[model samples]
Target chain A: MRPVLIMVGREFRDGLRNRRVVGTTLLMAALSLTLALLGSAPTGTVGTSALSVTVVSLSSLTIFLVPLIALLISYDAIAGEVDRGTMLLLLSYPVTRWQILTGKFIGHVCILTLATILGYGAAGVAVSFANGVAEQGAAASFAVMIGSSVLLGAAFIALGYVVSVLVLDPRTAGGIAIGLWLFFVVLYDMALLGLLIADQGKNITTGVLSVMLLANPADIYRLLNLTGFSNISTLSGMAGLSAQVMLSGTALVGALVAWIVVPLSAAGLIFARRQM
Target chain B: MTSPSVRLVGVSKHYGTLHAVAGLDLELHQAERVALVGHNGAGKSTLIKLMLGVIRPTEGHVEVLGVDPAHHAFAAVRMSMGFLPENVVFPPSMTGAEVLSFYARLKRQPVSRNRALLERVGIAAAASRPVRTYSKGMRQRLGLAQALIGEPRVLLLDEPTTGLDPASRQSFYEIVAEFGQKGTTVLLSSHVLAEIEHQADRVVMLDHGRKVADGTLSDLRRLSGFPTCIRIGLPSGVRFHPELPAGMAECRDLDERTMEIRCSDASKLDVLRYLLDAAVPLADIEIAPPSLDDIYVDILRRMAAE
Candidate 1:
């Protein structure tokens, strides 16, 4: 445990010196501010207001941006060290391989979480100010959005670790990480929609669809923040599908938690089995 | 006598079909500096890694500081061990001090000592600067400082002085010598046989995953069976080559006033006495013994012949 903590401290220092923490924080903040400014234009209406509308836009932005950012930061966690010729030296220390992996995981997750909270928090404050005081229960739903978005970022962080450990080279791991981002963010929804259309409402049951959507961490994140509350689901545009899917709030959160743990465990195992 | 710092008993490691290290047995005592010389694929690096417990051997046993390398308790051994790999790159964004502190923390050493280590390795001024701004030799010095953390009892250095200039290399050896005097068992691998010939207390020659030779410099010279040459220079304008020794070989004149005689290891003094007894109008006599390079080549030749 001491070794792990030492490694975590080192990794965190490395992140700060590299300016990854600051750069990512700034980027998340800027994008979220833009989404909030544009997303809050329809507040004070009969339908949705600042908090719920911001949640909708922020969730959409997260699907595109959070995983991409997480992958960008974490895809080289192991492979990059090996390429730069530091892995062997680091391994020569008394610490075990699992400690190094866990340390790096903790450090990178800290960076991403910092970026998520501060970035989204700034936008949340800005949106609340623009709407002339937030409504009742809206602040609670907004908190849930920020929290679930962090989970989304963590799930992708673990997935990036899987890519980093399994791939032999940093360049290959980087390419595969981008491919993963495209598959999950852009191509996955299109492919699922295609599968639904081709089914012609015959073979693709609602149960199958729910399972399929839950398989993607981004979708699970969306379900967690966008569906449970009324104002969020109405503006999130997932009310019809949410009614059909039929999942409690706990089950959706559990699925996202599994996404973070399972891939992280696999990465640790692969790193342990590896030669370097 | 103190127990060996490192001991390998019939140890071998194979990666799939390729034998990285064949069945081998070797031991390194405390304060003993051994140079591991070999070709590119001769298993020197693998052997170092095996002793460091970075990789487990497939067959037989490896005992480093009295603990099997594969054991969980070997971390205690590692605390007293330092390693500088052939290519060691510190994280670029970290300051030199930060890098040393990072390694110091991981090594479980007192962080306050890191500043002195940086000063010891002559990188103190650059301690506050990021490592990316460092040159190759400076980076290597930083690597040495990290390895010196906790003053490891057993140091495994693979081509450590590769990028160091001559002066830096000399200081590096001085530091290593200081550590050696304090009872650090140092094993460094290098392809340049001449550089470490005088530095190492003993030399171990490896050939294609096998230990072909291991001994002190004089022991190796005696074992290699290479002849030592005695060159005698006659006085100016005196060209009489008068060497009447039957057993001595290659007694011939090279220039107007010089004669050379080659003799076996056992008969070097005998030939010298015969030349002196003959009173061969000599100017000066020089005896050239077999060098470590010659013994190493001879050992490799013998290994290949088998």
Candidate 2:
């Protein structure tokens, strides 16, 4: 346990010093803050709190950006270290493979958490100040959005670690991570939408659609932050889909957690069995 | 023997049909410094990996500090073992001190000592500089410092001196020698036999994934049975051309005043007696025993012949 904590500390410090991490943090803050300011522009007439409007816009932005940021930061976690020969020296330490993976996972998740909070928190705060005062319900949904964004990022980070551990080549892992990002965040939703339109409710029922949405961590994230709350759902224009989908917010968050755990565990198992 | 700090019994590691390391046995007692020598693909690195538990052997057992390295509990033992791989690399963005401290934390050693370690490796000046700015030699020295983090009970260095200059190499050996005196079991692999021949207390030669020879230098010297060269320098004006021992020895004239004779250890006394009997004035006689390189090449040749 002590070794694992030490590893976590090292990995966290490494992430903090990393140029990519710093750049992504700044990018995340700038984009989310811009979205906040721009998103609250029309909220003056909508009568909803500025924070709730920001939540709707930020949830939409997170669906596209958070996973990309997470994958980009974590795609080379294992594969790059292995290629650089640092993995060999690391494995020679007293720490176990699972400990290394755990440390990296916790550390990367911490980075994503910091980025999501600071990046999106600044936006939330800015919108609150701009709109005088935010409603209690809107602030609650906004907080949930931030928490769920971190979950969404964590799920993708774990998936990226899986790719990193299995491939043992940073370039290949990076490519695969991008492909994963596209598949989950963009192509999967597009394909599902295409399938739904083609099926025309003849075969694809709401229940099946709900299951399909739950299959993707990004969709689950979208479902949670966009559709979980009635007020935010109405503002985000997901009220109809929210009513159609029978899944609960708890279930969506559970699926996202599962996404994180399963891939991270798989990475640990494969890493343990992998030769240095 | 203090219960052999490292022991391998009939260990084998195979990758597909290629035997990276065939069934072999080796042992290193406490405080012994053994050099592992072989050509590329000779399993020197594989053996190190097996001992380090980075890769499990396909067969047999490997025990380091009385712990089976392949088992989970070896992590505890691993804290007491240090390794420097063939092409050691550190994170380019990390400073030298950061690298040492990171490894020190991993080994559960006090990070405060890392400054001294960097100083010992002569990289104290670059301690705060990122590894990318370091020369190849400086990085190698940092790798050595990382390996020495906790003053491991067992040290394994694979081609540790590759990028080091002569002075660094000398200091590297000096540091390793200091560790050896304190009861650290050291196993280092190298392609340059002459460089480590004097530093290692014993030599283990491998070929085709199997150990061909393992013994002290003199033991291998005797086992190889290669000739020892005896150079005799006569008085500056003496013209002596003797040595017709017929198959017992071979003689060659080096210059006008020097002659060289090669004979097995068994026939060395006979050749000297014959020279004395011939009343050849021997001014200065120098006996050159077979170096580790000669014995290594001879052993490999003999193995190939077999």
Candidate 3:
């Protein structure tokens, strides 16, 4: 446990030294602030609270941005070390492979946490100040959005590690990470929409659709942030689907946690068995 | 009488159809410096990896500090072991001090000691500089410093001085020698046999993933059975010839006033006695034994022939 914590400290410091922390935090903050400031302009006409409107816009933006930043930072986590021949020396230390994996996972998740909280938090605070006061329920919904955004980033980071350990080099890992991002965040939905169109709601009921959404972490994140809050759900147009979907917010968050654990465990296993 | 610091009993590592190591048995006593000599693909690095437990042997056992490295308990044993791999690298964004401290914390050693290690490796002046700004030699020195952390009981260095300058290599060997005197078992592998010839207590040669030769320098020289050469300098323009002693001894004129005698180790003294008895005015006499390089080549050639 001491060794694992030591490893985590080193990795986190590495993230700082290499600008991974600052770069990601700034990228998230800049983008979220833009969305928060501009996307909430329609609240004046829609009669919705400015913060809830910001949540709807931010959740939509996070589904694409957070995972991209997460994958970009994590795709090379293991493969880069192997390619640089540093992993050989690192492995020769007293730490176990699982400890190394766990340390790196925690370290990277911390980076994402910092990025999501500070990034979206800046946006949330700005919107509240502009709107004169924060509503109790809307503020709670905004907090959940920030917390779940970090979870969503963690899930993708875990997926990136799965790719990092499986590949021989970072170039291949980078290519695979992008492919996974497209498949989950973009192409999977397009394919699902195609399937729904082809079925014409015959065999694919809302229940099956909800279960299928659980398969991709991105959709789970979308469900958690966009539909978990009543006011935000109405604003995001997910109110109807949220009512029909049997999964509660806890179940969705659990599924996201599972997304993080399962892939991260797989990464640890593959890393342990790796010859180098 | 104490158990060997490291022992390998019939260890073999196979990657699919290719055998990286094949039925290797070896041992290193406390404080002994064993130089692993082999060409690329000769399993030198593979053997180190097996001992480090980063890769498991397909067969047999590897024990370091009395614990099987591949076992579940080896992580504790690894605290006392240090490995410096060939072409070792660190994250470029990290300063040299940060790099050493990072490894120090991982080894559970005090980071405060890393300052002395940096100075010992002659990299203290550059300790605060990012690793990316360092030269190859500086990086190699940093690698050695990290490996020396915790004063590990077992140290494994694979081609540790490949990029070092001659002076740096000299200091590197000095550091290694210092550690060896402190009772640390060191197994260093290098293609530069001449560099380690005088440094290592014993030499182990690998060929095709098998141990082909293992012995001290003189022991290998004797086992090779190669002749020793004696060069005698005579008076200017003295082109005299003399009958050599019995046994496998050959005499030939190298040039005017110089004659060379090649004789087996057993007959070397006999030939020298004959030279003194002949009353030949000898200006100089130089005896050269078979070097490790020559012996290594001969051994490899013999293995190839077999």
Clash totals, every prediction = 0, 0, 0
- Which model is ahead, 1 or 2, in terms of TM-score? 1
Better of 2 and 3 by lDDT: 3
In model 3, the clashing pairs are: none
> Where is model 3 more than 4 Å wrong at Cα?
B231-242, B251-260, B272-286
Per-residue lDDT tens digits for candidate 1, residues B1-306, read 999999999989999999999999999999999999987889999999898888889898999899997889988888889999888898888899988888888888999999899999999999999899999989989988989999999999999988789899889888888898899999999888878878899999888788888899888888988889888888888866554556667677788777788888889887777777887677898888877777788877876787
Residue A148, candidate 1: Cα error in Å is 1.6
| lDDT (10s digit) by residue, model 2, range A8-122 | 7877887777665677778888998998888788776766888888888889899999999889888899999899888888888988889988988888888888888888888
Q: Write the per-residue lDDT of candidate 2 for residues B62-115, one digit (tens) a residue.
A: 999999987778888988899998889987878988888888888889999988
Q: Measured by TM-score, how close is model 2 to the native structure?
A: 0.93
Best by DockQ: 3
Native-referenced Cα lDDT, model 2: 0.89
TM-score of 1: 0.94
i-RMSD of all predictions: 1.1, 1.3, 1.0
Residue A193 error for model 3, in Å?
0.6
lDDT of each: 0.87, 0.89, 0.90
